[model samples]
Structure formats: C-alpha cells, structure tokens
Target: MLQGWGIWALGGVQRIGRAHIFLAHVLLGLPGLLLRLRLLVREMYVVGVLSMLLIAISGLFVGMVLALQGHNVLSEFDAEQSLGVLVAASLVRELGPVVTALLFSGRAGSALTAEIGLMKATEQLSGMEMMAVDPIKRVVAPRFFAGLLSMPLLAALFSMVGVLGGYFVGVGLLGVDEGAFWAQMQAKIDFEEDIINGIIKSLVFGLIVTWIAVFEGYDAVPTAEGVSRATTRSVVYSAFAVLGSDFVLTALMLRGE
Candidate 1:
C-alpha cells in the first residue's frame, strides 16, 4: 500500500513537470506562430463554424445580464444611459475573449485531444512517420491555425452579439434612450484599441488551449485511462491558460494605452 501511494505521487509530479516543460517549449516557438500553417481554410471552417453557436448564445445572455446589472448600479448615480459604454467595456475587455475561449476550450480542445490520442493509439501517427510526413506540421499546424482563426471571429461575434443584447435590455426592456446610450459609449470609450486588444487576447488563448490539448494527446500512452487523463488535463490546462493569459495580456495592453 505504501509503495503504491508513493508511486502515484511520483507519477503525478512527473506528469505536471512534463506538462510545464511542454508549455515552455511551445512558448519558445513564438517566432513560428504566424508562419505555421496547414489546412488553413479547412481549419478555419472547423474552428469558426463549429464554435459559433455557443459564442453567439453565450454572448447574447451575458450582454443582457450586463445591461441589467449596469442599469441597477449606474442608475444610483443618474448615469443610466451610460449602459452602452458599460456593455461595450465588459464585452470587449473582459467577457468577450474569456467566455469564447472557455467555450472553445471545452469543445475544440477536448476534440483535439481525443482525435490525436486515438490516432496515437491506432498507430496512424506512426504510419505517417514511416511515410516521411511530419505529424506535427500536418496535424498540429492545421489545428493551431483553426484555433487561432476561430478565436478572432468568435471574439468579434461575442462583441457584436453582446452589444445587441445590451441594447435590447437597455433600450427595449429598460426604455432608456438608444441614442444617449451610443453617444455615451462613443464619447467615453476607445473602441478601436479595445476591440483589437480583445481579439488579440482571444487568438493567444485559442492557440494555448489547442496546443496543450494536442501535445497531451500526442504524447498520451496507448491506454483508455491514459487518454481519459489527458483529456481532463487538457480542459484544466485550457481554463488556466486562457484566464492567466487574459490577465497578462489585458495588463500589457492597458499599460501601453
């Protein structure tokens, strides 16, 4: 019993260590980030089409909530019509990328892990190696592109849907003046830079999530339990990486502005 417990602990530590090391390796390949591409359009379609529904639905609901909450709080200060600015700020800066990334991580990241793990288990990857095809370039490259492309599209979708939802609650539901809302938003916010920042963060998050999932699956052992463990780890890592990178990117973008 003691030996078994000791081995389990050591295995946990080693898995963690390897995961971190793998992340570091990917981080070091920043220069290759833009140029790495395979099945670019196909990947984009997968990322964009498959993930759009969730992003749209989530953004719609979140925007409504934001309008409601902002109305309640800002009405106290007689700044009720500033709802547009509030909605725009939350959607573009905080919620847009974060929510979309979380959704994508759940759907796309798990799919990537399972696909790669299955390939590994079936020795399809080995066959590719025997055929002198680089599995990383073939598999990872397309997926990385797909994740990256989908992120910006999803971020834009989130921003648009969130804004519309906020408008619905603020103008239609709350009976606030629509013009006043947009006016305040235009005057108070830097829409250009903030949108760019949000999109950039989303792209980074997508890349990180897919990379972690693919890496784990690629290295997964040929066992059902091992594949399951990798999938779980992919999700946990996806969430952590998305959130952590969001904070870092937000700070850096805001600091320069």
Candidate 2:
C-alpha cells in the first residue's frame, strides 16, 4: 500500500510538471497576444466588468466585518481610532488580493474552463488546428493575458471599496474619530510596501488561476462529462494554488523585514 501510494504521488507530480511545460508553451505566444488585442479586450470585459459587482459586494462586507471586530478589540485597549490602519492594512496586505483571486477563480476562471471545454467538446479547437491555426495563439493567449491584467485592477477595487466599508462602519456607525481613521491609515500604510506587494500578489494569482483554468479546459476529455469535470477541477485547483502560493509569497515578501 505504501509503495502504491508513493507511485501515485509521483505520477501526480509528473502530470503537474507536464502541465507547467504546457503553460510555458502558451506563454511563449505573448506576441500573438498583442496581435489579438481586440479579442483580449473583449475577454477583459467579460472577466473584469462582469465580475465587478460581486467583488464590490464581497469587499464591502469583508471590510465592515473587519471594522466591527477590530473596533471591539481596539476599544478594549483605548485604541479605537486605529481602526483605519487595521482595516487598510488587512485589506491591502492580504484580504484584497486573496479574496479577489478567490472570486475570480469562481467566476471568471470557471467560465474560461467551461467555455473552452465546451468548445473542445464541440470540436472547435480541433477545427482550428485542422486549419493550420494555433489554438493556443488564437484562443488561449488573449484570455490568459486578459486575466493576468484584470486581477490587479480587481484587487485594487476590492481594497478601495473595503476601506470605504470600514470607514462607514468605524466612523459612521461606531463613532470612531473620522480624522484619526484616515490619518492613521495614511501615516502607516506605505504605498510601496503594502499596496505594491498586494498588486504583485494579485498578478501572480492571475497567472496561476488562468493557467490552470485554460489547461484543464484544453486537456479535458472531449465529451460533456469531461467538460463538466474539467470546469469543476479548474476552480478547485485554482483556489488551492492561490492559497498555497500566497503563503510562500507572504513569507518571502516579509522575510528579514
């Protein structure tokens, strides 16, 4: 049993390695991505704009919850006014990118996988290949680039809205001092250290999520059952990858600092 389990684990690792190489091939078509700017923009609209409402709603609620809980803690120490710093730091340094990536995995990532999987099931990708067309260049590259570009913007929007929600809860409802809230946040939240790192996290998440999504769709068995399975796997795998990578990145980014 132990040897069989070990063999299974090694096989899984090899499959993952192969998937990474496949993604690298897709990435090599970066110039083709630029050449297909129109398609890329369309995908951006689908992946970014269509997903904004949910991101906004989730961000607001998360911020509000953070403020409520943070105020409870800080008030005990007579530091209620530091709510701004707490909320802003939490959102910018961690929650913003992580939550946005999770949302993207559910909304845009699953959509990409399902769309491509269905196309594969319907023989569209094969038809393109039969015409001497590179499906990766024409079909995958634009969507990949769009996801890569959209994640940071979505994370920024999420952080901004979350901050606003925190403000509403902390200052409007809880009677925390408004000026102290904003001022403390502005004073402590370094743009380079906090904001830029958050953006970097979002970008890395975008690459991982999209790569998994498209690869699952492309390699899925060309059947209805296969397409459905691939779509589910894409979201699950993307979520795990985002969370796992976030831990490693946070450790690296904060090391010796």
Candidate 3:
C-alpha cells in the first residue's frame, strides 16, 4: 500500500490504525503519567541528556537562521524590530514542537521499536503474558508516559535555542538593541497561549511517536528480516505522522485564531 497507486488505501489504513494507537496512548498515558512520576523524572533526565547535544547543536543553527530569514524579510518592510516577536512566535508555536517531535521520533521512536522487537524475538512479551503482568502497562506504559513528559521538555529546550539564535543573529550580528529585542518580544507575545499550544502539540507528538513504535514492534515478524522491516516502518510512519499532525494542528490553531 505504500506504492503511488495504493496511496489512498495506505492513508486510510494508517489513519485508522493511528487513531486506535492514539487513543490507546492517551488512555494508557493518563494513569501511567500520573502514577509514574518517578519514571517521568528519570525519563526527563534521559531525554534531556540524550538530546542535549542535539538540542543545542540544532538550536544554535535554528536561531541563526530564524534571525537571518527574519532580517531579510522584515528588512524589505523596514520593520527590523519585528524580528524578536517573529522569532518568539515562530519558535513557540511552530518550530519548537515540530523540530523536537521529529528529533524525538527519530531517536526515541526507533529505539523503542528495536527494543520491543528484540524483546519479541526473545519471547519476553510472551513470557510477561504468561506471568500475568500486563505488558502494555508494564512495558509500553512507562515509555508512553516518558514520551509524554519528554515532549514539552524537548520543545522548551528547542524554543530556548531558537530564541537565542534570534538573539545572536539580531543583536550580535545585526546590531539590534538588546532591550529592543526583549521589549518587542514582550509587547507582541501571548505567553499563556503560545506555551499551551506548544504543550498541546508536544503531547500529541509524543503520543504519535510512542504509538507508532509500539505498534510496529508488536507486529514485527520473526527473524532479523522482520525486525529490520519493523524498524524501517517505525521511522517512516513516525516521520509521516509527525509531519501530518503538525500540519493538522497548525491549521486548526490558525483557524481558531
């Protein structure tokens, strides 16, 4: 169904399957999210630590580009001062969550699939089922909550980087006044809304990554070939889901605004 002629079929199947997985993620994440605060904390550390180099490296370039792009466009209008607000808004609402989600999808999503697929190959899940432990709650649930907790942390980190990128580009490179950057940021921004939007987007993205990974792993066939197929599918589907959801959320948010 991945072929061009089967695109519609693939979309429909993916949508239905994704919806089921999404619902599972939310329901699973709620109790797990509340009860697994300790795991959440640890997962935060792992995600933040694992992603720090990425967040910083990506963020630095992101910030530089945001400012560079803003300068080019706003300069045409002679409204260079809008750079700060533009960067702030763009990072908070859009780039922050989208970029973080893609990164998380690549890093965490593939890892989750491989780990679970390995477990399946080793019969760990069958063993768990035989032992009467709920595999979903015991295994998938923690990771689910972990993704939920990690999304905002990652997004916030990216936004910070993006904002700093703007700062360096605006002030250090462009010679914009420092106070003016902050002042413009404060003047045009609605922190509550932007923050909430960022969180909401992250939450959905977290759910998407976790669900795709788990589904692919659980469905993996036997032998190394099956594992490889599952891994490839995990990355492909997770990336597609992230981009599709980002577009959907952006459209919905824009329509509301």
Q: Write one digit per residue (lDDT tens) for candidate 3, span 1-257.
A: 35875998887788678758645754665675576677666655655568767876787788889899998999899888888998999888888888888887777778778877888888998899999966766676666667667778888888998898889989899987788888989888776678888889988987787778877777778567898899898889888988998999988887887
Least well predicted 10-residue stretch by lDDT in candidate 3: 21-30
Span of 10 residues, lowest total lDDT, candidate 1: 29-38
Error of 3 at 123 (Å): 1.1
Question: Which one is best on lDDT?
Answer: 2
RMSD of 2: 1.3
What lDDT does model 3 reach?
A: 0.80
- Cα lDDT tens digits for candidate 1, 67-150: 999999999999898999999999988899898888888888888888888888888888898998767666666676677667
RMSD, one per candidate, in order: 3.6, 1.3, 3.4
For candidate 2, lDDT tens digit of each residue in 1-257? 99999999998898799888878878888887777688889989988999999999999999999999999999999999899999999999999999999999999999999998898999999999999998888888888888999999999999999999999999999999989999999999998889889999999999999999998998888999999999999999999999999999999889936
If the candidates were sorted by their TM-score against the true structure, best first, what order would they fall in? 2, 3, 1
Candidate 2 runs further than 4 Å off: none
- Overall lDDT per candidate, in order of appearance: 0.82, 0.93, 0.80
- Shift in Å, residue 248, candidate 3: 1.8
